[model samples]
Target: MALLALVLLAQVPPAQADPPISQPAGPHAVGLRVIQPAAPREAGLPAQVLIWYPADTSVSDAPPLRYGDLMATRLSALRTDLSATQLREGRAQQQASLMRRLGVSGQAVLDAPLQARSQAVPAPGRFPLVVYAAGVGGPADENADLFEYLASHGYVVVSSVGMGADGREVEETLAHVEPQVATLQALIRQAPQWTAADPQRVAVMGWSWGGMSNLFAAARDPQIGAIISLDGTREPALTRQIDVQRLTAPWLYVSRSPDTIAQIQRSGIDTTFSLLNAAQYAEVTQLIVYPMQHADFVSRRMREASDAGYGEYSRAEVRQAFGMVALYVRHFLDAHLRQQASSLEFLARKPVANGAVPHSLRIDIRPPAKP
Candidate 1:
């Protein structure tokens, strides 16, 4: 599969190419913390949850959180046979690839004190919580760049490792999805203890399988106020299970290109039914990124994959589309979770009017159906 090919290529060293990644434009610096829930529902897999939050600007000088380190750790855990030398080489290759593609060393600082905890003054009001769900068998930090970007923008972002009931690759069935949903609920319940997260104003963001799982979590837990799916929510069987009436949360669905959709159809998979189409009672905003494929929605894959991974799109074009995805995600959260008037207006305008590259994406906004 293309995903397997990208993973294999990420382990190989790439030629140095400094294509700039759109850095987080938020004012606050980013801080990260990994918390092991006292009572995790899925005990079989690593239950450590990653929390990214706004941090004091002074901590920006702290050492950058190496993406390679995170990738290497997850890899070593999965493949116990790799030697120390092999692991080190893998780490180096991962970092080198990131540097080549993203043009940045790293964007986040590890365990830097939260803005509230660092200051002696009164704590600021809590930030909205965004629970991130990774793709099947993906790590908690699967979309590290997005987490950091959201954190910098003052949202408390949280994610856990994605695995099935067997503690391995997640399957697309209720039996497997139940554990993922449970993990999300557990994280939501523990948000207050972990950071300055406002549980009442919670949003669930997922990619691929995680995208579908977040819908399940939101359907079960009414506390979720918004949902963001990155090339997710397209699964027919999973979408059929969600009660759209219960999924009243405003949704932001970022999808792959039309060509990719056609390609899926060519493979004999039905591409007609979609959760986004079914949930008409709820407000929905969909952005079709013309350059991105299913895997490109995940920043790790976007940055590490070989040039061919982007298909006919240029690296710069794909990177631009990815950056636009982050911007839209931020505004969507701001509009629904923070109730910011500017963000609401931003979402209402055309993609070009909102500064997105022309022809790079298509946006459609559907207001909630009148009662």
Candidate 2:
């Protein structure tokens, strides 16, 4: 029976006809597809995924492309146009501000399952799936640059557009998150290019609010082998989650202290880390708080020159964050997803600068909530 199901599933392609395309799609912009259930599919919530990657080969002798990179030439173009002055000019770091300031002036609605539809450049291929969520009221593609960053490195990154606060009431974001996760898993399980991917090696990442949801999502789904928080700290979602034991996956929760969601000061999220039972903040999980603030984790300033945004760390500091996110996710996923050898440095805990360290993170390995 299982063999028959596999045979039937194999016949289905990764996407439907008139496929929903990835933004900046093509060999030039080409990364991969986010497998999506038809927007109007009669089922519950529809699903979709979009991914980008460094091609099997590059046109020039530039440095090997980074994840979410269009390719060396393209990134170089964006980078070359960037200048220190431009980087410090305006609120470029506040992705929301930058987005609002540069409103979708010329975009045409594209009709997505969740989004109002805006212009998206189409690129396609088989790659890893990196699921992304937006900041508070932020568009799904608001962080395309980041998604592109990961996709270019040879992964299919999906950014789900949930209900927005723009012109509508914000429904519970969780409403559709699970279906999206399911869709992504289906794409991996049934995607045409699963062979190019390490099935066991998928990662869920998001900035701010998305990050919080992903943290909770990771806890709930054991199949999610790795979890990443880009400048997001534990809030009600990660810290005070009701069903604590529902989560057990290894996490790389990275954040900057000053950023709004970076640290939930009121909730005492930091305490969750240090207070966890030794087994809770066990070897499998780790969290790192950067000296920099939230914007520092996003290399947006690196891509576009401007500083009129949340205070920043440094291109060098922000760059450190990018590297760490990629390195850790790469390491964890590679080992678990690809079933291949990878450095466990990411999983290692470094000693504190102060000799008075009792615990690095405060986590309590408590039992599951009563039904």
Candidate 3:
């Protein structure tokens, strides 16, 4: 049966393959702390918030983060065995035995962080908060690398696990939005204890469906200072329900496919740019990565590439693409959340930072006339 499964896996789509991904080194050493905060909206389901932050010491020699069991549990529940073994075996620094024989392990660390210790004294001042939501059928740590990098760079990154349809069930995706928002609100309420979290400056980011949720949350809640999307768009009905023009937060969207961007445009999100208010579209930046599948936004350990759109690139290429994507994410947060003018200036000048990347990527800033 295992042999037959492997054969069937080989026939699976290229987009579905699990490629190895490195944490993409960041400035500060990273640390993690997990909290289960129950939101009032979905009191039955307590949300699990994975908090990643800059460590007081270097994490180079710290024990690697492990998530093989997490991936296996999520996958087995979905009836997908495509790369469960690979995830299970590569729990540490090395690949699983089966993947090693196939020569397909692409150098990914399943876990990130040296220790689960909290940084005492809170790294000088309260850090801006980043509430991250995962894609449909994804866990909070689906984009572990991105969260770790943000945390390492003096940000309090919080992601919810039970707030999304994280087990490959699309039908439940939309229904989880309100609960996800409630979860984030509850986490914010508890931020005073986190010490590192700055309740005043909060940014919400997400991948795929999570992206749409954050967008909705931003529309409803004015407290969110910024918004970031990893290839997510409005669900049509969402546009009709909420008035996006009321959303004044600076927005950054990094998408892999043009279709998704067009979908956002068709949903009338693009029209908000032309409003008379000068600040309406000043900070809205849309980035489209070429030759990058939706899976690239995800960590290699748990990516479901088969169902992703076409054009398969090697592991190295995917890493380079995502690194660039991460850079944009970092700089955007710096500009909006941290209120750094230099970061915004740098982004305007160097929109697409392609350092020998195989494909040509494009970054579009709204209005085209903003400084």
- Scored by lDDT, the top model is 1
Candidate 1, run of 10 with poorest lDDT = 105-114
Off by over 4 Å in 3: 1-24, 38-47, 58-122, 162-174, 260-282, 301-312, 352-359, 367-371
Rank the models by TM-score, top first: 1, 3, 2
- The per-model lDDT (C-alpha) reads 0.74, 0.43, 0.61
For residues 1-371, write the lDDT of model 2, one tens digit per residue: 99999888865432211112222222333333333445423433223334444444333333322222221122222133455565444223333443354343101111112211121233344455566655554444444455544544456565544333332433444543444344334443543353344455566777765666665566655556656666653443335542446555555555554335644566455544431332253223444545346544443333333334434354444444444444455555555445455345334434232211233222111332333
Candidate 2: which stretches are off by over 4 Å? 1-37, 40-49, 58-128, 142-149, 164-200, 237-239, 258-284, 287-291, 299-305, 310-312, 339-341, 346-371
Deviation in Å, model 3, residue 292 alpha carbon: 1.3
Q: Using alpha carbons, what is the TM-score of model 3? A: 0.70
Which is superior by lDDT, 2 or 3? 3
Ordering by lDDT: 1, 3, 2
Q: Summarize candidate 1's per-residue lDDT along 50-117 as a digit string, tens digits.
A: 67888777544544554444565565544446888898888677666555654542322111112222
What TM-score against the true fold does each predicted structure earn? 0.81, 0.53, 0.70
Q: Which whole-number lDDT from 0 to 100 does residue 113 have in model 2?
A: 21
